[model samples]
Target chain A: DAGVTQSPTHLIKTRGQHVTLRCSPISGHKSVSWYQQVLGQGPQFIFQYYEKEERGRGNFPDRFSARQFPNYSSELNVNALLLGDSALYLCASSADSFSYNSPLHFGNGTRLTVT
Target chain B: QQQVKQSPQSLIVQKGGISIINCAYENTAFDYFPWYQQFPGKGPALLIAIRPDVSEKKEGRFTISFNKSAKQFSLHIMDSQPGDSATYFCAAEDDKIIFGKGTRLHILP
Candidate 1:
């Protein structure tokens, strides 16, 4: 099966503008999570959606929000982009909540650049 | 309290050697521990993971050693090769996944 896929492989936007990122989970998977990986650092959890409901949210600001579709796809929206928002936005999917039997598979990621 | 601290920041080793990376977590609720490998321009891929109930788990040349009591774990790469070079991240998970800063491993051929 194809791995998790993310759209607009790369994006550029001005500070204070808004950006929307999209992700399609692997077939049969019902969970999708978003993370931000700043340069020289590991990924930080942003949000997680399961079965069209908000299952978990990270420490990100209100400007960062996400929603899941009936088909299990997801979109991450960031408002008032800051230069600090420049980083690789990653999307990972799991068959279910992460457990010993089920793990996360990630997409290449959408590189968001805020100038 | 949800941070997973990883070390060595970076490492360089000769081929056929052993590569080790260490991590410590402050969140006792983290029940699952996993290691991820990331190459430039790509997302991280899960390498191996272990539960708190086990002391060790191995797959091929990759091994995860967990010390539950100490809240620490480490990743061991046996017979390391140049292909093994990449940024490796250690993560702890419960309701959400938290990752370490990452360790850049460079294996010399």
Candidate 2:
């Protein structure tokens, strides 16, 4: 079975620009989450969607938003990007959400570099 | 209180030696503690995890030692191999996961 897959492995954009990253979860998984990993730091949670509904949110700004599709794929969008936004955006999937025991499976992540 | 503090931002160990990384979490409400390993150009993969009710859990050469009263946990990699070289993260899970800053471990061949 294929693991979580993300698109546009590498992206470069300018400040004030907008970018969209995509993710396809593992088959039979119903939960998808997004995280931002700065260089030399661990991943920080951004948003989590379960059954296509927003189930959890992190401390990220309003400029960051995400939505899950019926097919269980997800898209993360960042608006008015800044140099601080440059980081690896990771997508994770699980069998379900709110179940603490459900381990997360992650994608290689999309490397976003804001110029 | 949401922070999970990890030590030794980086580590170097000889092959067949023991590599230990420690983490301290402030949130007692966190019911689960998990360790993840990530390689270059790849996402983190679950290594081992333990719940608050258990003091320790071991899988293969990896072990997680949890101290609830101390609010601390550590990952022990026995028989460390070069293949184990990567960034390791300690995480606390509630509805979502809170990850530590990460420890880069380089095992000498």
Residue-level lDDT tens digits of model 1 in A20-106: 999999999999999999999999999988888888999999999999999999999999999999999999998886645588999
TM-score of chain A of each: 0.97, 0.97
lDDT of each: 0.94, 0.94
Off by over 4 Å in 1: none
Model 2 misplacement above 4 A: none
The residue pairs that clash in candidate 2, if any, are: none
Per-residue error for A29 in candidate 2, Å, reads 0.4
What are the DockQ scores of the candidates, in order?
0.88, 0.81
TM-scores for candidates 1 onward, in order: 0.98, 0.98
